[model samples]
Target: MAESGQDQTKYLKGPDQIIPSDVLKTWEPMGAVKLKMTKSGVDANPPISVPSLLRRAADKFPDVKALCVKRDGAWKSITYREYFAKVCTLAKAFIKLGLERFHGVCILGFNSPEWFISDLAAIFAGGFACGIYTTNSPEACEHCAISSRAQIFVVENQKQLDKVLEIRERLPDLKAIIQYIGKPTSAGVLSWDDVMALGEKEPEEQLDYRLSCIAANQCCTLIFTSGTTGPPKGVMLSHDNMTWTAHANSVNIDFALGKEVVISFLPLSHVAAQMSDMYMCMYSGVSVYFAQPDALKGSLAATMKEVRPTVLLSVPRVWEKIYEKLMEVGKSTKGMKKSVATWAKSIGSEICERRQKQDFGKPVLYPIANKILFKKIKKALGLDRCKIFISAAAPISNEILRYFHSINVPLTEIYGMSESCGPHTVGVETAFKIGSCGRTPPGFYTKLLDKDKDGNGEICMNGRHISMGYLHMEGETHEAIDDEGWLHTGDIGHLDLDNFLFITGRIKELIVTAGGENVAPVIIEETLKGELPCIGNCMLIGDRRKFLSALLTMKTDMDMDTGEPMGTLQPLALDWCKSVGSQAKTTRDILEGPDEKVMRAIQAGIDRTNSKAISNAQRIQKWQILPKDFSIPGGELGPTMKVKRSFVAEKYSDIIERLYDV
Candidate 1:
């Protein structure tokens, strides 16, 4: 926990203010480090507001492709000028609808051009915009709208609108509902066209004045936490917080204006997408392509081939699938193709090892290997033009990172939270570390609080990118951010001498055995998955128990072509199960009624994991195969694909008790 140089006396309110001793101990001040590009005038003249960033892009790169979206089976482009104009019109429409400055307008939908436009319009109109997750239940949506004191709600279509309508009675402050597509099913609901028409009648001067009046310190967006532990909190990010992040990331990554292309598919509700796909693109003048909700599972490859984006941001699951597919491809190859693939992969591994050791001097075989092997692999994955591929939002397996890097993909992992306005630290390709999450970027300083014998502690951060605080939760806000402005990220990690961060696990996720031995479950879980490729999701359970146990799920129901679920076991998965002597013919049978042979295979994996455990207590004593994998729709995972540990534990408490009962 590091403190900034800002005056702390102003934060100490009330005459009887006695700060807790625990809080005082956590406030260890640390020195700030600047990004290399910052010294060379990279962020010398950063934009002050989101609207200003969009305006600057339109003014300087008017003819540049600002946005592309698939419509009528064709990709349609919107130039910077057109984007700015649309944003302005939307802003004017919000004004005409009587949206006052600093009022809240919530967008509930999937990621699309309309969603982005609506977000910018809110900012342009001096309104604080918030996004509700598409996977959220009606009750969850109600919570967000009520928490933000939303005055207006925007829905993508009938389904999203239905959720809002079901909870409309609970949101008394709500004044209007706008639907982006289709006819409004209820009276008082406005269509997208109707809003735009209203904007045409409103004076443009009003929108301009509102944008001008917006201050950098004013809150512009409310991003809710994933609510893995409890109800989601609205993280209030100021205009300055977002703008600084966009500028810092652009400069650090060396983004090329009007040249870099990106695909926007991650949920807009998350700050990661906001920072990388929206704000950074606006500031760096990068053309962004929007993908449909089903595109990732249906036409992601086709879209990627068409766009040939230079930057790709994705979650760990997507990368894992890609890695698995590559492995499957290798397994299915024969004869000369197989031999060539093996040789190429060996060369790739050699190059990766050399690069990790800082040996940039190329070996004579490297170029040949690249031409014959790596180049073709990259093209097949539609990543031939990709310069920066980022995996974030959740911890990715080191095995997956190594596989990609071996194939000439400079895949890197970043670390951050919604409270930090996206990423505070990112692995640069040149300085990438396999297991570490990279160094703290410019404008941010990190410190470890309450270190243990292993030097691991809660990772605390302080910076311009930090959010204002949770909306309307003063007590929780104080608990998260101290009086000195340091945000206490509950994640547990340690930094190396070079400032590279290695996240071990979350403090809340630590499992303590009955004997009082502490262990990080994620470490063991990741190890099991790495060793047993068939294991999709693993959860370790042993709090207040004699020994650790696990709940396992297999990656079975997936489409071979698109990596999308086909609602049954894939042929490859079935073959893998059978190869291990399983008689199961379906995903249900493999999981719910696993044969003795399948059980033996699972036990073998646990035995291998136990051999690597530090102590008997750390080893999993027993385990069970879950009938199904954790998913967002099932309420077992968050929108970001992170397992809701508490929820899953509670939902399967009977199964967990059965493990210990034996």
Candidate 2:
């Protein structure tokens, strides 16, 4: 794939790097208002670079444990001083290996210490870091690398390295490929050990000079979109964007400095995880523990039990799985155990309700409930020490929220896109409501545009936390951010009387019916899922059709090794089937046998959902269940489990057409 005889000298220059002219050209006018607010003022935070934040954190908590990684059946700790020292060393090593300024240092892997080090070192060396999702194909990886003009590419293991090696020659700007987890088999590739050795041999003079030239306003990272609508566009984020947002998040959550602990398992490629696991931890001096690579699959609970973190952030699917498992276990209880659990749950729910209303007075049975049920449940889930639980990326069902609340774990919702640097609004302990995205945090402003009769409009945000526009996509960037610096999030939502933001739907996902009525499918889909315990996923389809219909997937077991959905129904789903007097053991069994009981139950759920529809257009008139559940490997869900609505619609066009045809 190599273009023979191409000049590589420019990329191999020493550490006296300046932000490239092409990269500078990508910076749009961030608007006069934004610039004004960015300047030091009485109410604004002084702009700080990420490198500066890390240095301060190291100085303040030199001996405090900052990172924990499991190796050889044991957890190993790295202190703040050591973490800072290693980052500086890696930065110097990148310079020695000819990393260019403003270019990308692309990392591909699961969450790990090496991934964290690679990300920060790239920024510290005056280059922007880009994380490629582990689920991305080789072509997708090449797209991000080429778009950013990446020079140094780091991967976690052989699998990721192989993806790069297959396309390495085409990456004309690439200077080195470093494999962090294991030794590289390819010629001229560097191992993680080689990087450290290079750092040890390199002098500190040039690295220090490079660090001095760093600025807060320059782009330091690129977060690629999930590409559901089209190809992924790199969202450029400035150092100030990361640092300020981290500080704001810490304040919003009331993070305890050097005391807050978190599990790092979510895909780091996403802005939410990067801001939380990496930047927020540095800003707050919080300790981070790396979960196993398969944390999402099954091992996360073990990690949680071991670490017992104080802060937890997850996408809704994780919480749903936990809830489902708890319910499955609860179903098996008999006699006295069942009676006590039922009583305890009621008491817990009552206590939580009182707490939400600012009443600390516990129900008379609260002590007994806490001792008999709540405490044990929290301990089993390894959330006994958890003080904050945040759910983001997508809307979580209120049923799941209420279920957790009843168990003494309230899930707080945070809302934002990558363009807003992860969070523009967050639910805090004192002001959160179920299904609400919470209030805009300090240092950010939210406004609604083009309001309908109901007061719902497109959500817009303006703040120091907003990103520096998309890279190399000026037209798209302009469409997203207006002249006043408001990032026009295409999401439809409204601020309540108390300023809590409730997301209704997305403009792009709106299913306009043939009757000339606009329909938001998410509310209907969520409502349908809430009515059907056996259903794993639901996608409402009928854009420009006569009426709404849905494509449903029954909750089926998954092949954990391959991350593919299996035909057999999940235990929760089987229990649900049994409750409906159906003996179906698999999705195939239910569909092929045309199980009257199961089919009737599903139809009843649809009828119940339709009964509450706001309009006839929003009602589900017909629906069909798919043979398998949605999964990451199945191309139905994204990395964080957000449904790829467009993709799903396209994939099921035949079935949707059949529904309309009939």
Return the TM-score for each candidate structure: 0.91, 0.94
Please identify model 2 stretches exceeding 4 Å from their true place.
Answer: 1-43
lDDT tens readout by residue for model 2, 229-293: 99999998888788888988887778998888999999999999999999999988999999999
Off by over 4 Å in 1: 1-47, 558-567, 591-593
Q: Residue-wise lDDT of candidate 1 within 1-662, one digit each (tens)? A: 11334333332221112121212211111111121114334334443677777888899889999889887888888999999999999999888887876578899987888899999998888777899898888999989888877788999999899999899989988888999978887878999999888887888888867765665554678898888878998888877678878988898888998789999988899999999988999888899998777654656767787888899999998787778778888788899988887787777777677776767666678788889888898888888898999999998888888888777787888899999999988887777689888888866789999999889999999877877777777688889988777889989999987789999988789998899988899889999988777777899999999889999877766453443333355455666678898867665776565477888988898999999999999998898877766666567777788989999999999999999895
lDDT of each: 0.80, 0.85
Candidate whose lDDT is highest: 2
What's the lDDT of the predicted structure labeled candidate 1?
0.80
Q: Highest TM-score among the candidates is held by which one? A: 2
RMSD of candidates 1 onward, in order: 6.1, 4.6
Q: 443 in model 1: Cα distance from truth in Å?
A: 2.1
